[model samples]
Target: MRRKYNPYALPPWLKKSRDVLHQFAIPFCIFQGIRTILFPTAFDVLFLIALVLITVALKIELL
Candidate 1:
């Protein structure tokens, strides 16, 4: 059987860090998106994709 997940079980510092990253994920994705649009490089594209996936995961509380 799988154990239930609990955010409150995380340490204070770790919880804070997760909150900070959760807040910043969107802006980071936006910036990377614009950068990728302007430069159109392979690395930029890949990075933007990764950022978008991470942002989605964070928004959905799956990360």
Candidate 2:
């Protein structure tokens, strides 16, 4: 029989905060994206960028 590989097993922290991000960040990004589209502005652009960067940092366990 073959065994399945697990990335989270290699590093326990890899799956850390997985639920939190899914429950909050993902949905927030969708709403924020819509708001930025309807009312485009410099602050909205910066906020979107910040959100994306923060999501990436959290995904890589940097923050």
Clash pairs detected, candidate 2: none
lDDT of 1 by residue, 1-63 (tens): 998888888899988998999999999989988888888999999998898898888888886
Error of 2 at 53 (Å): 0.5
lDDT of 2 at 52: 82
Q: TM-score of every model?
A: 0.88, 0.60
- Global lDDT of model 1: 0.89
Worst 10 residues of 2 by lDDT: 6-15
How many residue pairs collide in each prediction? 0, 0
lDDT (tens digit, per residue) of candidate 2 on 1-63: 996755556555545556567457767777889999999999998898888887777677655
Model 1 pairs in collision? none
Off by over 4 Å in 2: 1-22
